[model samples]
Target chain A: MRLSNLADYAVVTMSAAARHCGGGRTSAAELAAETGLPVPTVQKVVSKLSAAGLLRSVRGAGGGLQLARPAAAITLADIVEAVEGPIALTACIDGDECAVDHTCSVKPHWPAVNAALRGALAGIPLTQLSKAAPREPNPSGISA
Target chain B: MRLSNLADYAVVTMSAAARHCGGGRTSAAELAAETGLPVPTVQKVVSKLSAAGLLRSVRGAGGGLQLARPAAAITLADIVEAVEGPIALTACIDGDECAVDHTCSVKPHWPAVNAALRGALAGIPLTQLSKAAPREPNPSGISA
Candidate 1:
C-alpha cells in the first residue's frame, strides 16, 4: 500500500526539522525551501505536527517551530501519526463501521497486525533519519 | 497514509479464500459474493493476485482459483504486495525519480523504514486472518 502524498511530505518536512535541531527554530516557509515542498503544504503539515505536539510553535519574532523533544526520542510512527491518525491499516481496526465486520473473520486479527506495523515504525529513531553534517573538503590534493 | 481501497479489498478477498481452504476452487464472482465486493472489482483484484502467484487459476469446467499455498504460508505482506506492488512507504525507497532526492537527507534511511514495515506485514500469517469456525450450539440452556 502506498503512503499518501501528505504523509510522505510530513516525513520529508520532519527530516528537515531534524536536521535543523539545536540550530534554532524554523518556519514553514523555511522548511518548504529546505524540503523543496510547496509553502502551503508545509504550513498544513506544520500545523498538524504542532497540534500533535511533535512540534512546538511560537508566534513572536525570533520564534518559529522546533521539535518538541530530542530527535532521538521521536520516531517515524510519531511523524506518521501526527499527519495521519493512529497507524491503522484498516478502518475496522479504528472501530469504523464496516459492512463486512460481522461476517469478516479477519476483523479480530487486524489490531495485532496494526500493532506490528506501528512497532516497526517506532523502531526507527529520527536521529537515524537526519543527514550527517556535510564533511569539509580535503585539505590536501592527495587522498587522506 | 491509508492502504488504498483496492489493497483493503484484496485482503478481504484473500481472507475469504483462506476460509474456504480445502473446500475447492472459487471464482471471482464467488469471491465477490462471499466478500460483498462488486464483481468487477473482485475480477481486477483476482487478476493481480493471480499474476503475483498468490492465487492459481485453472480454466475449464469444474475449475476455478485457489490459494497458491496453505493459508499459513501466505502473509499479509504477500497479499498487499500482490495488489500494490512492493510495500514501500515512500517513492524514494523504490529508486523512483524524486525532485527532492538530491537534497533530502532522509532518503538513505527510508530503506530501513520500508524494510521494517514490510517485515511487520510479513509476520502476520494469512491463517490468522481466516475466520475461525463457529462453535457448536450448546444443547443445554446454559451458555457454554
Candidate 2:
C-alpha cells in the first residue's frame, strides 16, 4: 500500500511549496532543488497540480507558482489525487478487470471502503505538513 | 493508491475461501477456479496467507485449506499486510529514502496518517467481502 514514487514526490513538492507560500511564488526548479527531486519530475507534478486546481501560476517577472488556495484548505488527498486520479484502491472499481467481477461480492462495497480511505487522507491539511516536528533531546549535547 | 495485484488477488482469494467455510475445506485449485485466478497465483497467495496465520492447511484425506479463524475475525488490513508488509504509504517510514527527511516536517505525522488508513481497512471484515450487494430494481420486472 505504498504511494507511487510520483505521488510521494508530489507530497514533498507540495510541502516545499506550502513552506514558500507566504513569502512569494516559487518556481518548479526551486521546488525540485528544495525537495531534491528531478527538474522534469517536479515540472510534471507542477503541471498536473495546476490542472487539478491545487496550484495557480503567474507569468512575467517575479511570477511563478503558488497554492491555488490557502494551505489549510488543501489536503493530502488533493495532492495525491492531483498526481494520481481518484483514489480507487482496486482496478475493478473502474472496469471488469477482475475475472470474477460478475460474481465478486467485494466489488459492491469498494466505493464505501474507498471513501473511508480517502477520508483519512482528507483529514490531513497541507498546513500540517509544513510544521516541523519537535526536536528530540540531545544526549550528546551536540547539534541535532 | 491502488492495491498491488497480489494484494488484490489476496482479497479475492480470501473472499472465495470465506464462502466455502461451512461447506468444507477448500484447496488452492478450488479457490483459483472460484476466484478466476491462476493456479500458481493462488498457491502463492495461499502460502503468504498461511504464513500470516490467516489460513491453515490440513493434511491427508479430505483435508485442505480453511481460515485459521472465523471470517468475521479477519480484516482487510490483515490480508494486505500479509502480502505487502506494513502499510506505510511512503518510503520515508522505514529508511531515509526521501531526500528531505533530515528536516522534513511531514515526516513526524506519517505514522498517524498510516494508522488512520490502516484503521479504515481494519474496519472491514472478511465476512463483508463474501456477502453480495443487494440486487438492483428490475424495471421490466424480470429476474435480476
Candidate 3:
C-alpha cells in the first residue's frame, strides 16, 4: 500500500546520484546536501545501495561514489528493492505463512499481481527520474 | 514494498466473503473463522470495508453482511484503497512534501507511475481472487 520511508529515501538519493552521473562521482555529504537528507541517513542508504550494487563506492583519493550501472539501467523497483528487499506486496508470497494460507485462494494469484506491480516500477528508468520537470504547455501562451 | 497487514488481511477477508456470496449473507465472526483472522480484526476491517461501500451491512435478524457490489465488480485496488486510502506509493505524491521536493524531478512523474501501480491492482477482480487455484499441467503424468 505504501513504501517504507527508507525505500522512498532511496529513490530520492538515487535520483540525486544520477544527476551527478555525468560529472563523474559524488560523495554522501554532497548527495545528502543536495537531497536535504541527514548525513547519517544518506550514509545508511548509500551503504545499502552499495551492497545492492546500485551504487559503487570508490576508495582513496578522488574516489567517492558512483552508480554501478548506467542510470537508464536502474529503476524505481531496483531502488525500492535495494532498501526493502523484493517487490512482493504481501508476505505470504515469500513463504511466510499467513493465518489464512491453507485456505486462501488469493495467494496463488499473487505472483502475477506482484509481477505487474514490479513491471510498473521497472518501466520507470532512473534517467527519467533524474531530469527536471518539463514545463506544461500553455494553450493561452501564458507561463506560470 | 509490502502491504500493511490490514491491507493483506482485507484481501483474504474479502476473498472469504466472495465465497459466501451465493449463500446470501455472512457475519464478521464467520469471516474471521473462515479466514482464521481474529474476530476483532475482522470486525475492524469489515467496518472499513463497509464504510468504503465494498461491503453492505444488512440489518435485522436474518441479515448480516454481503458484498455491496458484485464480486467481479470489486477489484484489488478497490479493496486495497478501501483500507489503505489511495494507492500512491510515496507520501509526497499525496502532498506530503519530502525534503527534496524543491529539486526532485521524480515528483512530477509520480502520477503516471502511481496510475500504473493502481492499474495493476485494478486489473485483478475479487472474483478471480476468490477462485480456487487451477491444477498445474503435469507433463510426465506423475501424480505427487
Among these predictions, the greatest DockQ belongs to 3
For candidate 3, give the docking quality class from DockQ: acceptable
TM-score of each: 0.84, 0.87, 0.90
Model 2 C-alpha lDDT per residue in residues B1-144, reported as the tens digit of each score: 888999988998999999898987999999988888889999999999999999999878778899999999999999999999888888787664675443666777777778778888888999888878623333232111
Per-residue CA lDDT of candidate 2, range A15-69, in tens?
A: 9999889888899999888877789999988888999999998979788999999
Q: Name the better of 1 and 3 by TM-score.
A: 3
Question: After aligning candidate 3 to the native by TM-score, how far in Å is the CA of B63 from where it should be?
Answer: 3.1
Query: Which candidate, 1 or 3, would have the higher DockQ against the true structure?
Result: 3
| Docking quality category of candidate 1 according to DockQ thresholds | acceptable
Better of 1 and 2 by lDDT: 2
Lowest lDDT 10-mer window, candidate 1 chain A?
A: A135-144
lDDT of 3 by residue, B17-113 (tens): 9989999899988999888889999989999999999999987887889999999999999999999998887788776878554577777767777
TM-score of chain B of each: 0.86, 0.86, 0.88
Q: What Cα-based lDDT does every candidate model obtain? A: 0.79, 0.83, 0.84
Q: After superposition, how far is residue A135 of candidate 1 from its true place, in Å?
A: 17
Q: What share of the reference contacts survives in each candidate? A: 0.55, 0.55, 0.69
- Give one digit per residue, the lDDT tens place, for model 1 in A1-144: 667778878888888898787888888899998788889998999899899999999888878999999999999889898888888888876768675534777666666667667877887788877856422244232111
lDDT string for model 3 (A1-144, tens) is: 888888878898899898888899899999989888899999999999999999999988778899999999999889998999988888887878885545778887777778878888888899888778733343232110
